[model samples]
Structure formats: C-alpha cells, structure tokens
Target: MDIPLPTIAVVGLGTMGTGIAEVLARAGREVIGIDISDAAARRAARALEASTARAVGRGRISAAERRAVLARFRTFSDLRAAADAGLVIEVVPESYETKLGVLRALDGIVAPSAVLATGTNALSVTRLAAESARPERVLGLHFFHPAPVMRLVEVVSSVLTSDRAVAAVTALARELGKEPVAVGDRPGFVADGLLFGYLNQAAAMYECGYASREDIDAAMRLGCGLPMGPLALLDLIGVDTARTVLDAMHAASHDRLHAPSPVLRQLVDAGLTGRKAGRGFYTYEAPGSAVPVPDALTPSPAAGAVPGRQVASVGVVGSGTMASGIAEVFAVAGYGVVLTARSPEKAAAARERIAASLARSVDRGRISAGARDATLARIVPAGSADALAEVDLAVEAVAEDLEVKRRLFATLDKVCRPGAVLATTTSSLPVVACARATSRPADVVGMHFFNPAPAMKLVEVVRTVLTCDEAHATVREVAATVRKHPVDCGDRAGFIVNALLFPYLNNAVKMVGEHYATPDDIDAAMKLGGGYPMGPFELLDVVGLDVSLAIERALHREFRDPGLAPAPLLEHLVAAGCLGRKTGRGFREYGRR
Candidate 1:
C-alpha cells in the first residue's frame, strides 16, 4: 500500500523555509506556509512562484505542473491556519529562545499527534524537544541549504522522541526524494560535527599563514576532488553563519577544534558576512551575488629568495605505481625522464604503466594523442642508479621503510652531480632522515605528492633544517614546472595534508565506534553537508584501513596528542584483516564479501 503524503506546515518562510515549502508542495503535499507578517508571507510567496517559474524555464516542470504545484501552497500570517497540519517544520532563525517560543505556540495549537520538526543545523534537538508539551512528537528534520536541490536530510531523534515520530519523518523525507539518515540528537548532528572541525582547521591554516587561501582551497579541490575549497565554501555559506555554527558546536562538545578561528569572527564583525553581504574572503558585485571578484584580503604567494636552477632532465627511482606516476608527471612537462628499477623487467613494466596512464589521459581529453605519445617518448627505462649521473634532479618513490630510503639516497648522492637536488616522496616519514643518508644533506629535500601524481596538483615542498635555500628554491621551481602548486612546510610527520586529513578521518571512525552515527550516515553527512568528494569511511576504505591506522599512529606519536591517536575501531578492523579495499572489508564491505 502506498503511504499517503502528510499535510505539511512550514513556518518562518525565509530562504530555507520557502525552499522547504516549495519542496513539500511539489511532492504533492498540501503545504501551509506561515510567516510572522504580511510582507514576509508575500515575499515568500513571490520567491516560491519565481523558483517554480525557473523550474518551468529549465523544463524541470511543465507550466501546468508549476500551476498545479503552486495550487498546493497556502500562505498565512497566522499560526492557527497550521493547526490542522499533520507535520509542522519550523524554519525560524537559529535562536534557541525563538525556536522554543514557536514550539510552545505550536504545542497549544496543533493536533495532539502532529509531529513538530525543527530545521536546525546546529542547536540541541533534545533541548528544543523539552519546550514542547508533547516531546515524543518532536524531532529534527535538518535539511541542507537549497532544500529542493540538496538530497540529504538528517532525521534527528531526541531521547524523548518516539520511534513512530522518527519513522514518519524519515518516510516523509523519502517521499520528497531525499536520502534521510537517522541521527541521535547532538549539537551539529553528524554533518556539522564532522564538517565544522575541518572548516575551522582550514581557517586556522589561513590565519597562521600555513598557506594562502587560494592554495589551501586549490589543494583540496585539485588534490582531493572536493566540490569547493574550504574558504570559498565558507564564503558561500556566510562567514557569520559559519561562526554561529562553530560557536554552537563548541559550546555543546567543548572540543577546541570547533571554536571559530579569530579571523572568522573578525570578518563577521566587519559585516563581511559572505556572498549575501557582498564581501567575506572574496568580494562580490552585490549582496547575494555568486560571482566573486578579487578582494583586498587576497594573499600573495611567497616569493622564493634564491633563484631556481635549470633542469633539463630528471630521474625517478622504483617500479611502484607512485614512481611510474611521478615519471609521467616529469615527462609530460617535457623533462627527459630516466625511470630506474631493480631489474630490466621491472623498469619495462614501469614504462608500460606510464604509457598506459598517458593513453588514458588522452582518452579523457586531458591531453592530446600527440602529447601522450611525446610524453611517453621522454620517459627512458633504466635499471641502475648510474643512469641518474647527469640528471639535475632525482626523486626516489620507493617503499616507506626508512632504511630502504636511506640506502637509496646514499647511492643517489654518490652518482648524481654535486649540485643536483635529491628529493624523497615520503608522505609520513621524516625528510631529514633521508637527508642524513645523503652525503650532501644541503641538497636533499622532500617533495611529497598526492597519489596518482599525474592527476593531483598539490606538492608539499618540505625543507629540512640542513637544506639550503637554493635547494628549496629549485624544488619549488620544479613543482611549478610540473604544473603543481607548491606549498612550503617544515619536515614534519604527516606534513600538512596527512596531518590534517588523517585526524578528521579518525574522528569519523570514533563517531562510528561510539555509535553516535552509522558509517553510511556519517559518510552521507560529510559528502552532502560538507561538500567533500568522499566520506571519511569511503576514503578510509579506498586508502585501506591499515594505511589510515598507520598514518594516524604516526601523527599521534609525533604530536603526542590523544586526539591524533588511532581509533580503537580502526585498529580492530585492521587486526581483523579488514584492511579496506585491499582486503575487501573495512568500515564497509566490498567485493564478494
């Protein structure tokens, strides 16, 4: 039997409320849209009609369908009109007192069984439920912005909420074509819990001068494939709104990470709220405009003090995937690449891998067929370190074992020219360790590249204490030559990306272990709410649980921070042989398991 759609009432018809009302009405529900004043109600009605007309223009709905959808909506400035609604979703401003007052009013007017839901992104649902006489009928129906477009909805249930109330809301969300995930009543719930921490960290990164806003955003976008960089997304979300969300999460969790960065508060105080205010991290032509223009706050890239040395040729070590990819990156940039492996067969295999990767790039229109063939031609297969004797730079992409890297560096230091730059592509291990192995520590540096080096655009140019200015400048130039954004940082365990990224992933695991949220729900929250390309669990599965555990442990050991410690669940999964994609099992199951 088909479940009948409920008569929905959306109160406080602002942007979010109006969108919810539109979504409910389009889903064939009789929607009562309410506001505090006649002008507010009229504005909401006009917004809804304009949005529906846009749908008609886009062929998303016919003119007849638009009219039919509009017919389902009834606007009112009085609360009594919604007394008969089966479900009431309050989209009032995110003020606890204001929401509580509205809930109390609804409690007096609505039917005894009517479900009262709040469209809160932050704020305690449990606390909100306390304001209602019928707490069992109160739940949270937290929707992302532009409710009609975003597919995810967090259905939060307080301890006092009845299961039937939660189920009804979940079913209603499904009826509206949304992916609803059940969550326990917690401040920020699942999405903002995982999201705001990352955003705050990004803000801290900018404030501390770790990297420019553009570079930080570019790194995530081009490296991790996120929909938008943190700063740009912050601007779109409104700096003031972000500050409010962060403050709420901090008050609830007492986690220092959720505290809004001082810069964020300052920007909000300056009335640079975001796109809605025409200025934030970036400037806009007018309030509510999407187009961003360069602002006075734009950060300038650090100018390298030493001049970069010329490099006509580069040599890469190892036969691994990273090695092949690195060789391809250098080759595609028109550098003569000498790729070496332990044996002739291994070197031949690496060449084939590089050729295949370039061919795929051509197939995807990333490069032309001519460029692919030309890139492959520049990569020469070699079986010995002696092949790097004349190269200007040699980067080793061998296994993570320190001794292995140490031994390789020693050999390269002897074979390569006196001034040739030596780099190690270690993501977690210390760059200084590799430098110590080389006779000329001044010439050695770390050039950490993300996986699939040919595709990723960010390169961490690490400078050790012993590294000279010239060596750092040369590597930075080489990174730019290969079309990668170079961010300078000291030689540290996990560096920037791994240090920041692993802890966030581990927190998601901890949240699952604590049963605060399910893996699927957490993943959906991060992806849909946070605009991440992959949820933490999904990323862990791809990166392998064992690898994530290893990185987290390294970070913990280096920082001596409990928060960086590997989650017990991660260790248990790895110990159980559930090492993610490799073992076909981790946070989630894969393959034929």
Candidate 2:
C-alpha cells in the first residue's frame, strides 16, 4: 500500500521555502506556496521564473516543460491555499514559538490524514509534535539551503510520529530526487550536529587570535579540502541563527563543545548577523550579497612582516614519500637540493621514486620532458647528514616521533653550518623541543606540508618562542618560492588543521557507536548537505585508523577535555588490528594495497 503525496504546500516562502516549492513543482507535483508578506510571495514567484528560464536556456528543460512547472506552482498570502495539500511543510524561522504557531494553525486547514512537518534544524521536533492537534502526523522534514541543489532531506521522526506518515514522506522525498535520511528527534540530527561544533571551534579559535580569520578559513579549505572556510560559512549561515542552533544543542547535551562561542553573541548583538546584514565574520558588498569586500578586520599583505633569510640550496633528510616529495618541490623551484638518507641505496631509491612521479607528470602533459630532466638533475642524493653541511636550509621528514626528531636535530646541529636554517616537518611534536636540541635554538622551525607535498599547496609556517624572526621568515619565503600558500600559527599540538579536524572525527565515531545513525547515512548527510569532499569515515579509512587514533590521543592529552578523548570504539578497533585500508578493515573494509 502506497500513499502518493502529489500535492504539497510549502509555508513561509523565504530562500529555503522557495527552493522547496520550485523542486516540488519541477518534480511534477502541485505546490502551493504560502508567505505572510506579499513581497516575499511575489519574490518567490519571480525567482522561480528566472530559475526555470535559465534551465530552458541551459537545455535542462524544454520551453513547454518550464511553462508546465511554472503552472504547477502557485503562491498565496493565506493558509487557506493549503487546504487541498496532502502534506504541509513549514519553513518559517527557527524559533520554537514561531514554528509551533504555524503547525497548530495548519491543523484545521488540511485533511485529517494530511502530514504536517516542521523544517527547524535546531528546535525539538517532538515538542512541536506534542503541541499539534494531530501528534501522530507531525514530524520534521528538513531540507538543506538551496534545496533544489542539495540532495539531502532529513526525515525526522519523533516518538509520537506515525510510521505511515514517515513512509509516505520518505517515498515522496525519493520521487523529488532527494536522499532522505531518517533521523531521531534531536537538535541538528546528523549533519548540523557535527557541523556546528566544528564551526563553533573555528569561531573560538579566531576570537582567541590563534590565527587570522583568512588564515583559519584558508587552512580548512586547502589543508582539509573543505569547500568553504568556517568563518565565511558562518557568514553565509547567519551568525544569529548559528547561536540559536548552538543554544538548543547545548540545552540538550550540555556539552561545552555545543555551547555557542561568545563571539557569535557579540556579532548578533551588533546587528552584524551575516551576509543578510552585509557584515559578520567578514563584510559583503551589500546586504544579502555574496561578494565579500575588504573590511577593517581583513589583513594587510605587508603589515609588520619581517624580512627572510636568503636560501639558494636546500637539504631534505629522510627517504620516505614526504622526503622525496619535498625534494622534488625544491628541485622544481630551481633550488639546489641535497636529499639524504640512512644509506646510499635508500637515497638513490628515493630519487628514483621522484623520477617516476615526474615521468607520470610528463606523460600527462603537465610538464615538459626537458623540465622533468632538469628537476631530476637538480636533486643530489647522499648517504649521510655530512652532505647537508653547506646547504642554506635543512628540512627533516622522518617518522612522527619526538626522540627521532630530537636526535636528528642534534645531528643537524653539529653537521650543518651555524647560520643554516634547521627545520622539522613534525606534524605534532613541539618545535621548541626540536630547537632546544640545537645550540642555535633560534634556527629551528616547523614547515608542515600535507601528504603528497607537491600537489597540496598549503604549508603551515610554525613559529615557536625560541624560533627567531629570520628562521620563520626564511620558511615562509621558501614556501612561496615553491608556490605554496603559507599560513602562520604558534607551535602547538595539532596546529590549525588538526586541532579542529580531529575533534569532529571523534564525534562522528561517537555518533556511530551510539547507534543513532549508520556510517552510510551520516556520510551521505555530510557529503550532500555540508559539501565535504569526503565523509569522516571515508577519510579515517584512508588515513589509517591507527594514525587517526594516535592523533586523537595527542589532542586529548594536550587539551585534557573529556570530549576530546579518543572514542572507545576507535581505540578498540585499533586494538583489534583493524587499522584501516592497509589492514583491509577499519570503519569500513577496503582491498589491501
């Protein structure tokens, strides 16, 4: 038995509501759009015409098809227009009182069996359902912003919600070409539950001046491959709205992670809500404009920057993939490269790996054969640290162990010349500790490059208290010479990227452990709703579970927050030897390489 919800009424025709109405009409369902303001109702109608016309111009729909879609959608200023709708979805504001009033009013308008849904991402769906006349038919149907584009629709079921009501809407969501994830009654459900906490951390980090807003945003975008930076995304999703969501989340869980940052409240009180108000984390060209204009908070390119020490030659130590990648990057940038390893054979093998990578680039037409030959010729592989004596800069790319790095820095201290800038590529160790191993503590710094260095453009230029201006500036300059975007941060546990990233990963593991959602549903929710390049579980599998758990431990040790502790599920998996793709099992199974 199937219930076809062919006629849908979308209440409150704002951006999200209008997008929903357009999607329903395009899917061959009659859509009645209701908004209190005549202007908003008219604006939605105009936006649909422009959208459908663009679709016709782009060959997405024929002229006849566009006309029919337009005809299927009708706008009204009263709730009476929804009397014939089989389902009514209210996309009003996020306030509890505001949403409850709409659902109560819709109770008498639609048929007794007609389903009523609240589109609040933060408020309690169960509470809203309890206040409605037909509690069994009321639920939550939350669509992401720009509803026509994003494919995710969270079909939220409260305790009182009827199974038949859920089934009918789930089927309708599929017919509308959306992936509907069934979620329990909770603030944020799956996607926003994870998303908002990460955003709140980014806000708190900026508020504390850990990094510039631009640098914080850029680190996530380049380092983690996120579509937008946190601050910019906060501006897009109104600051006031974010605060409301966090408040609801904190009220339920009382986790400090869900507590809204003080900066959000400040921004809201100042009326700098977001792009809708033309200002927030960053300033836009105008109210409701997408373009960001320069503001007082924007960094000046030349402000207080110290000049860097010059380096014509570089020493890259170790024979791992990162070592070879670093050597290739320096060589490609026309710097003389001395690549060293534990043995002559290992050093030569590392160079051969570089040769193969460059050969692939040449075959793909990315670089000239002559350029590849030149890059290979510039790298001189050697068997010992003695070869690094005269190089202007020395970079260590060994395993992520503190003692191994300290011993290497002690070696670099004696072997290399006094003025040479000594550096370590340690992702999580203290740069200050590495510097202390050397007599010239001022010389050591951290230059963290993401995996497959030449392809990833971001480099974190780490500065410790012991690191002098010259050493810090030299790495920033060298990073630019090799065409990498450099972001600055103090010497700490995870730097910028890992600090915000690992905590979110830990929470996702907690979610799966709690049996609230499956990895597949949560992954789909984040990918389609939040625009992540890869889901957390997918990334955890790629980056070994062992590696992820180790980082999680490091962060928890440094922060000492209960929430930052590694999820017991992650630790148990590591204990069981299910250490991800390399082991052919992790959060998910994969073919062993």
Candidate 3:
C-alpha cells in the first residue's frame, strides 16, 4: 500500500533544505519552507525563484508552470507554518540536540497522521525516532546534496517506524522523479558508508604531507575518474559536517579509518568551513562560489627545478597489454621505442599488438592513416635486452611478482648504459625493493602507469629515498611528454591511486558479505548519489578480483591496521577461482565471451 503524502514541509532553509523544497514544489506538491532566520528564509525564496526561472528559460517548464511552482511553495520564519503539512522533513545541522529538539517541537504541531522525516546522511535514525512523540510516523529521508539534481534518495526506516509512514515517503520520492532506496536505519546506509571512509583516508593522506594537495587531487580526478579530489570535495562538503559524520561513524564502529583527521578539526576551528565560508581545503572565488583561486596550497608546475636527462630513445620490457600500451604511448610521442621480451617471438607479438591498436585509432578517426603507419614504424621489436643499450630510459613492465621485477631491474642495470634511467611499473610493490636489486639505486624510480596507458591520463611518479633528483624529474618530464598527468609520491604500497582505492573496494565486499545491501543497489547508490564513474563492484570485476585482493593484501601487510584486512569473501572468491571478468564470473555473472 503506497500512502500518498502531498502537503510537505521542509524545516531549515539551508542549501539542502531549499533544494528539497524546490524538488517538492516542482513535483506539483504543496511545499512549506521554514527556518529560524528570516534572512535564510528570504534566501531560499530567491534561490527557488531563480532556479525555476532558469528552468522555464531552458524550455523545461512554461512561464505559467513556473508561476504555479512558485505559488505552491511558500517560506516562513517559524515552525508553526508546518502545522498543516502532511510530512515535515528536518534538514537542520548535524547535532543530536538540534535534531531532537526540532522533532520534539514538531511532534505537538503536525497532525497525528502526519509523517516526519529527518534528512541525515550520518546519525542514528532509530535514536531520533525513539525520542520523538510519534515514533511510528518518523523515518529518514536522506537526499544527496543538490537534492533536486541528484536522483538518489535513501528512504531509511528504523525499527519503530510504521510501514504506512515508510510507504508514504517512498511513494512521494518516486512521484518526485527520484529513485528511492529503502535502507535500514544506520549511520551511512550504503553509499556514504563506503564513500566517507575513502574520503577520510584521503584527508589523512594529505594531512601527513605524503603528497601535495594538488597532486592528491589530480591523482584521484585523473586516476580514479572521480569528480573532485578528496580535499577539494571536503571543502565543498563543509569540513565541520564531514567531521560530524566521521565522529558518528567512528562512535558506531571503532574503525580507525573513520576517525576524523586532525586537519578537518583544525580547519573547522579556524572558521574555514569550505565553499560556504570561502575557504576550507582550498580558497574559493567567494562564499558559496565554485570558482577556485590560487592559494598557498596550490602547486607550481616548475617546482621540479632539477633538469631532466635528455631522452631520444626508450626501452619497454615484457609482452603484456601494459607493455604494448606503454610502447604505443612513447612511439606516438615521437620517441624511438625498443620493445623487448625474454623471447624474440613474444617481443614481436607485443609490437604487433601496438600495430593493431594504432590501426584501430586510425579506423576510428582518432589518428590519420599516415600517423598510424609512422607510429608503428617508431617501434623496434627485439628479443634481447642488449638492444636497450642505447636507450636513455628502460621501463620494466614485467610481471607484478617482486622477485621477477627485481631480477628484471638487475638485468636492465647490466644491459643499459650508465646514466640511463631505470623505472619499474609495479602497482603494489615498493619501488625501492626493485631499486635495491640494481647497483645504481639513485637512477631508479617508479613510473607506475594505469592500464591501457595510451588512454588513461594518470602516472604516479614514485620516488624512493635513494632515487636521484634527475631520475625523478626525467620520469615526470616523460610522463608529460606522453600526455599523462604525473603525480609524485614516496615509494609506498599502492602509491596514490591503489593505496586509497582498494580499501574502499574491500569495504564494499564486506557490505555485501554482511548482507547489508546487494550489488545492484549498492552500485546504483554510488553512481546516482556520489557521481562516481563506476560502482565499486563493477570496477572490482573489471579490475579482476584476484588483482584487487593482491593489492588489498599488500596494503594490509604494510599498514597492519585491522581495518585494512582483506575481506574474507574476497579471499574465498579468489580461492574458488571465480576471478572477475577474466573468469566470466565474479560479484555478478557475465556470460562467457
């Protein structure tokens, strides 16, 4: 039975509240927006008018419809305006006292049959409901930021919440052209449960000075295809609000990763609460403005003053897809590339793979026929590492096994001439381990490239304690030459991308293993709510669960933090040989190719 909820009131005319009111009014429902501050109520009114007017100008609504939308929406500076509302949604600050007080005061005002909802991404809905006068009528209606634009709305119901109230709110969400996902009353339901932990870790990564703010932001944006970097995202989501969410998550589950970073508290205390205040992790153009201006944290492109070694020729080792892709990237950038492997036959095949890849680019109009032929001509296939003697850069793209990479580095050290930069593309292993295998540790650095190197724009330039300044600069310069965004980091497990990425994947697996949510629902929540390019499970399958598990294990071993432990289900799947797309079955089944 889907109960109808037509007359709704949104208390607290903040950004979220105003957005919710707009959505309700646009859906042809009566909306009453209330706030304690008259100025806040006025701002919400103006914002609604501007938003609806823009909609009409875009031909989405007629001028008559815009007027009706405005007529159905009204604002007041008192809670009494919500007395006739069938549903009252509280989008106030994230405080137990503040939320509870609002619920208690509204309990006596609204009709007994009226439903009440709390708009909280974090915080216990059950606790809030239990303290309200009509516990059965209370539920959580968590809308993502910019509620009108975002399609996801988590319809959270506590144990005490009535089925009628849940039905009423759920139906209203669908009627408003939003996807409603019913969830149990928990601190971060599903999307935020996985999202905030990753955000917290990113904040911790930046706080410790492991990577520059710009590099961290660039790495995630280009590396993981995220909409924004963690610090910039934190600034966009007020730092104080994130701290509050983290505090609630930490108190519920004592996972250290959920513990708010010190930088968050420090920023909030300084009154630099993100874009709303003109500063947080970055300085915005103005209060509530998205435009970003230069600040002290912004990195200068010329900071790497060390001049890089001149490179005219490059050597790419191994016969895998990554090797072929790297060879193609350098060849297209006008560098002479020697493609070599342990056997001449394998090296020839790798070069042919690059030829086919370039041909496709020509077929698709990405490159001209002459350009493809010329790019293929630049690649020289060889069976021996001796061919790399004249190359200025020898990048080892061998197997991920540590010993294999160490042995290959040692081989490159013997074959390549002195002053030649030796680089390894091991995603999880420490570059220093491979560096120690070679006599010229100072000449070795990490040139970690993403899969399909020719397409992905990110390259994590990892530097070890022994790597020379020139070697580091050389990799950065080459990465730029190949049109990849290079972000520098210390020689550590997972570098910048995998270090922050795998943990989130592991937690997603845990959520499913614990029966909290299904893969489809979790996937939809992230794509619709968080604006991620792909859901965690979808990416895990594409990345191969086996490889993801290996990276997760490496991270856990390095951190020794209990929270970083690999999810048992991941190990079981790998043990059962249900590796992702490679095996045709993983978190979900895809038919055999």
TM-score against truth, every candidate = 0.92, 0.98, 0.98
- Residue lDDT tens for model 2, 281-347: 9999999999999988888768777888889999999999999999999999999999999999999
The segments of candidate 3 whose C-alpha lies over 4 angstroms from its true place after superposition are 301-304
Question: For candidate 1, lDDT tens digit of each residue in 1-593?
Answer: 22234688999988899889989989999999999878878988898899999999999999999998989999998889898898999999888999999999998898888889998888888988986799998999999888888988999999899988888888888888999999988777888777777778788878887667777777677767888888888998889888989999888767777779999999988999989999888788899998987677665555766787788999999999999999989998899999999988899999999888877888889899999888888988999999999999999999988999999999998899989999999999999999998889999999989898887888988888899988999999999999998877778787777766887898798899998988888888888766788899999999988888889888888878655678899999999999988887788787864
lDDT of each: 0.87, 0.93, 0.92
What's model 2's TM-score? 0.98
Where model 2 places Cα greater than 4 Å from the true spot, the runs are none
Model 3: weakest 10-residue lDDT segment is 295-304
**Deviation in Å, model 3, residue 38 alpha carbon:** 1.2
